[model samples]
Target: MNEKNTLLPRQLGDTHIRLLRIYKVVIESGGFAASEIELNISRPAISAAISELESLLKMKLCHRGRSGFAITDQGEKVYQSTLQLLGNLENFRSEMNAINTDLVGELNIGITDNLVTNEQQRLTRSLSTLKLRAPEVVINIRMISPNAIEAAVLDGQLHFGVVPELRSLSGLTYSSLYQERSQLYCSEEHPLFDKNNEAISDSTLCEYDAVIPNYPQPIKIKHQQKKLKSTATSTDREGLAFLILTGRFLGFLPVHFAQQWVAQNRLCSIDSHNRYFDTHFFTITRKGARENLILEAYLEELEKTL
Candidate 1:
């Protein structure tokens, strides 16, 4: 029997932690080549680190070859365990920082895209306030999907998340931020682009393929009596916009975000008045977690901005 195979989890050291972090980054980035910039390391270095990790565990973690990058079953298990371990480590750091009166440590926040263009969004104002009040605290913001935001908050990987309410999760708390308006959009090359809003009936609109968000549940569209065939799906605003711009699909996008495209004649709204929906955005945090003074102060600042 190999001596390393018998090593317990508690025996992991600083080297193991470093390797785990590298592994997490590679997986999150989707591939080793894609992770180079994020990890700020060479591809060879990353591969070496992964190999070291695999050796330490005495198991293969991933498959990287011409077929493309993929995580093995053991890799998935290790990845999940790493998340829990890192989350606990973060909680410990937060607890230690809370011992002092001064706000310090990092604040991880996740948000959905396209909010920067919305006039009603107060994220910048809240961030400014946080910086002024807590100069010692480091703030990190990640642009992610609503589902990812909720999951990160639940796992303690993110201190807070800003996302539209799709469905309620049991272990999370939500605070309303603002309402966002989304309208059906089509590219200039789309068949319905130059047509008058009234001329395009439901049956006519349904003729073209619909590009929808890749949410776990079906998205509810206002005044949509008939289901349009979903030909494509995207998890982010940028991807959805790209698909719509192909002129092959129709999709819903935030009005403010679609403004520039409309101005450039790249995209246009089908009917803003009748074919739009209001989505409520909220700030989510984990329930039953120890209250950190810094997080509380930041949340207070965010509420004031709202």
Candidate 2:
């Protein structure tokens, strides 16, 4: 029989996981001696751990010699598997801790960029209130793309996510949060900087270079987005705002987020009442996932504030 077939199947115990974790650090640290401070163990212990792990898996995981440390192909695959296993284990632990009435556990929230400046403050207040109610709860927020947020929530990597009300995804539930009003803007150096609604026509505004959001949008927003016919596109609201501030391009930005520049005369809206659109935002959570009391409490707080 080949060497691979000689190994018997076995369940991993705490010792096995510990050895795997040590092996992970060794791989990441690039050498056994390099991992000593991080692992808080001697070089000999780290070496022994890697050897034990290789024995359990019945493979030569790495090579260590005067030529320096190098992970074998099998070791690289095992390291990736170790990362996934540990992540799942932590998620399970956090979820279990959150199921009790005490609301003590971790809450991972993924949010689209630029929501921090929203005037409605629905999410901010909900998070603050959730913390007050559950002092022991650990709250983590990830600022990322709407698509990424939805995907994370679906996979149980994120407990909840806040994103624009674009097309809803399967296996997720959405709750209305607030609407963000966006309007076309030009900076002080633009030709239309001093123009008002009466001075700029729809055709006149379209003649300039423009930037538009690159993410997916609902039909209503898409129609408005098509009007500008942008030469540039950004995946996030912050990037859109940056392009708008350049004075070389006209773009849309959330009214609240643009106020900082508007108040300084650095930006002016172009026929805003006629060129604006409202994007509805929502909080989404995965359906049929294990119950999490911390998420529940936050949702309750959100409902109360909304």
Candidate with the greatest TM-score versus the true structure: 1
Q: Determine the backbone clash count of candidate 1.
A: 0
Mind sharing the TM-score for model 2? 0.72
Off by more than 4 A, model 2: 1-91, 98-100
Local distance difference test scores for all models: 0.82, 0.83
Q: Any runs in candidate 1 off by more than 4 Å, and if so which?
A: 1-15, 18-54, 59-84, 194-199, 217-219, 222-226
Give the TM-score (vs. native) of candidate 1: 0.76
Question: What lDDT tens digits, residue by residue, belong to model 2 across residues 184-251?
Answer: 88899899895646446668767899998877888898787788858999878888888888898998
Worst 10 residues of 2 by lDDT: 194-203
Backbone N/Cα/C clashes per model:
0, 0
